[model samples]
Target: MSTIKARALVLEEPGTQPVLAEVDVLDPGPGEVRIKIAASGVCGTDGHAIEGTHPLARWPIVLGHEGAGVVESVGEGVTGIGVGDHVVCALAVPCGTCRQCRRGLAEHCNSAARRQAMSGVMADGDSRLRYGGERAYPFFGVGTLAEYSTVRREQVIPIDPALPLDEFCLAGCGVITGYGAVMNVARVRPGDSVVVLGAGGVGANVIQAARAAGASTIVAVDAIPEKLELARTFGATHVVEASADVAKEIAAIEPDGADAVFEVVGKPELLTLCLSLTRVGGACVMVGIPPVGSKITFDAFTLTANRRLLGCRGGAVVPARDIERLVSLYRGGTLNLAGLIGRRIGLDDVFGALDALGKSTFARSVVVF
Candidate 1:
């Protein structure tokens, strides 16, 4: 019920630069909730959007999707959730009327408002955030980078108050995207052999989710040794250093090839290498966001025999259901939620954190409010 001034990361033009600006935030409208963000996780997608690398990405947007926060107020008709609730924001805000949503595929809901989640505007087609008297779009609908955000009620999922806010913040994007790809989309079953390429934040979650699903031999492939070490703690049975002989090393472990391969790094060249490591009936899940205008060419015959390559968006997840499940697992120690966070910084430190991402400084740096 109040207007708050918050700092946000805004990209004004395509192929331009991102600037942190202090903007005015409006109150929640019908079916919306105003959230006071506790922490927002910086992600590769935000970076891609800023660089104009993502096809769905737009310009002059406020960047950030992965966030955890406390609900400050609820708009009319928003029930079962109240103020002071600690929740994780799901970028996929399902509109029950959409064709995709009616078929139980809410994650792919194609409603106009749902699509606007990336547009950073409320469902009413107007923005709640303004800078210099102009409206600005948020990277994803939630705009977690800001101190407060007004979003549809469907976007917020409540979790246990005891859960660490910074750690649970990851469930909004990195954790859910990676973990859901394995459990929901790829469905890595017991005793299956799996390979995870690029052991970053998303990749790390994939490795652990695969292990939790009972994958017998889990191999993590990364150029960084520290990431490989962290992967082990998160349930990677084997760590393979990136080398010219990566395929050879992996094949040596699973002679018939791996049952599942997750490409977290968007290099098409590495994707080709990942194909070679997949068994005849194996599935290769691509979750990485490559820089814009990049394409990968592959042999058609390789995928003809049931060896499939699938792109997992939002981990093909049902956020409300999946987020709660992840929180429970995290609390039970079955899922290593706390281990994924590399460091925590304030909102102003977002640019520096993202810049470090280009290098190999840490797994995932979180921005706290």
Candidate 2:
């Protein structure tokens, strides 16, 4: 295979700052496609990987998974997708043979083959990138931070070329996670009440998705007033400034408590607290990415009422089906993707954006190629 040189943001190790370095990118192999990234959304997961917190994080990895771009090349046996097709790089690629996949729970697919891909290795157990003569893995197997990335066929989802790549890139992760949490995981129905904690990048989408699901009352909770205000634009019917009385505030909005509560803040204590806010038979979905190995306590009585506490990994996203639905919704004016973008920056400004993950923020900072 031929190799080409490209600049990528490489995280050499945990707790170290990522640097832009020119690296070698190998040509796509069988069942692989090379993508020329046009834009990528800077996400909290990237920050977590840089800090060695994400469970599937790997060292010496190229960062950035929420990317949309054009197909640059395709390898042997690759069909239906070819060079020049605009696509979004998907984070979850399920191995169809796995029990989880066959059972239609592809988002939770844990096959060894899928895990290897999640760790940034191809089917051959090798990396497509090399930095300073050493192998470098791609974060989440897509590595959209680079100008070019080679990924498995399932990871590259073709999209409508008319949609703006910068805004659509978010469909790969943040959008899909938030949207799918309500539509796929929690299954919030029309006239239901929803409570979304943390009005950040993904939280905002969760707020909107709840609205799309036709939730009658959407209460967005965040300590930042700016985010609470921004949450309204995305469909939060009411806003609550996070404090000791968050549950009380949510109760005021929904007397019996919300039908569904989403803990987007990823705090363990909050997970337990949010669980308490669900009605007797309501569901509480934890949509945040907690630190790997972090533990949370559940009040045993919380479940006696039939209140459900569920974990959402990437919104239980089934890539092939969900990505297409997202594009359609965006095109139909049903999904507000533009509202999710806070600012657009170049690759040079990624460090500033990456460091802003946990801080008070409402929208996403996308890196446009």
Candidate 3:
């Protein structure tokens, strides 16, 4: 097999910034393909991994997961994808044969294969990257922070090349997580009231999803006043300052509590607050990536009122199916993907964007190569 030398963001260790390094990208071994990255989204999870909080991340790893690219080559036993095909490298590709996958709950897949992939290895338990004369793993098996990425075929699904790859890339992580929290997990219905804590990237999508579902009221909460104004463009009916008596403010709009409450900030205290704002029989979904070893304490008594606390993983996305759905929505003008992108930056600007995660900002910052 041949090797391709590419410039990639390499994180040598946790609590350290990723540096640009030339890596030898190996040819796909089996059931794998190589991708030439076009655009990658800067996500809050990237910050978590950099802070040494992402449980699946280890040292000497590639630092990207939310991305879209074009297939460059296909390994043996690959089909339905070929060179020049535009695709989104899905972050939550489940092992279809796992027990959870078999049970139609692939989002909760806990099989060994899924675990291996999450830890940044392929089906064969090896990496395709070599940096500084040592093995380097992709972040979650589909690192897109580089000019090129080699990944298992299952991690990507082809999309129409006519659509802009930069915008569709957001669907890989933020859009899917936010939209699916309402549509899949909380099942927000028409005339329902929804509350989204943290009006960042994912929170904006939750607002959009609630709008699409015909919710009567979509309240967006955030500390950043700028993001609250930005959330209005994404379909938020009411914007509340995060520091206010949030529950009391929401109660004024929803006297019986909201039908769905989403905590997208990934703070343990917010999880407890989310449940408090959920109406009886409503759902409170945690859609953010909390740090490893963190604990959330909520009143167990809340469950007795028929309120549900759901932990959302990648919006419980079935990427192959959902990415297509998002594309269709984008085409029909129902999904406003273009408005979600706050900045289209270059790879050199990635650090600036990542640094702005908990601070003031946009719905998304995408690195366009």
Candidate 4:
């Protein structure tokens, strides 16, 4: 294939909007590879970056994290990956040399964090995008919004060539976030009861993961009827439409409340409700990113009853390992990744797709290249 210029949606300012612009992407450098993006999924975090709400972002940046593509070129020192290899981009690129990585916490690798966030050129770091002799930062380090990206070799994980790119693109973020939460973070046991609040893309995976973990009762709660319907397909044995009586409905099923309640909505009231729905000694995991300064208040007595409140980041996942496992589950027909893809659009239609996602509960819209 001939070298081609790529278009990327980049944020010019904080709290504004992103605009599509042409950019120059370099060939891979040492330990790097250039990927021809086949599909990119719009994630909630991308929305946050667009709104300039993410604490980890810098302006005049390219924002996109969920990406899947084919390897186009590999830099020196790269191995095991070759041109035409189908792969999914991972957000956390771990440097095994970091202190945290050595402790078996590669997700928290300080070196990787510095490198990925600093890789953006306009943001006072290395970068792959250039405009009129100026640099542009790639959000979350991958900048999958573009048609091509040169990223760290460790950031790409090969997937089954048989899996369609459009559908599995979501495995990069939402799918793995929820699925990993249940399988890795919670380690949910068989016969356990799970209450997942918010049946969005991530929430649905939580339901399916719980089912795969052999949870007996998977309760899905969402205000949208369509999402509740989707929850059933993913393994929710019981669905509760959100209302004032939601707690009552949930309590009727599990009189002592559920063993685990996941608050995926990120709203204060919803989180409080999730806390109320957890049985004594049960765990309540918060997976959503709430607005700045958002906090929840509850009675000390209730919290003292051995009720655990936990926060899960990146689904408490190590993407390289967990994503492969998830892909295996998908291949085995255990994880419903294809079903999570709500719609598919071309790059030219990405703006409209993003608008629709904000206005409606589009589980995920894949931008097929």
Q: What is the TM-score of each predicted model, taking all chains together?
A: 0.95, 0.98, 0.97, 0.93
lDDT of each: 0.84, 0.89, 0.88, 0.81
Model 2: clashing residue pairs?
A: none
183 Cα displacement, candidate 4 (Å): 1.2
The model with the greater TM-score, 2 or 4, is: 2
TM-score of 4: 0.93
Model 2 lDDT per residue over 83-187, tens place? 899998898878989898888777789799988888899998898889999999999999989999999998988987888999999999999999989998899
Candidate 1 has an lDDT of: 0.84
Instruction: Report the lDDT tens digits of candidate 1 across residue range 289-352.
Output: 7666678888878887789888888798888889878977777778887787788888778878
- Runs of candidate 3 exceeding 4 Å displacement: none
Ranking by TM-score: 2, 3, 1, 4
Q: How many backbone clashes does candidate 3 have?
A: 0
Q: Compute the lDDT of residue 109 as modeled in candidate 2.
A: 92
> How do the residues 1-369 of candidate 4 rate in per-residue lDDT, one tens digit apiece?
334479888788777867888878876777778899999998778888877777778667777889999999988888999999999988766667778888998766668454654344322246766654577667777889899988877778998788888877888888888987788676789999999998887898999999999999999998888888989999999999886498999999999988889988767667788889999998888888887777788876778989888877778777789998987898788988778888887777778766765345647788888
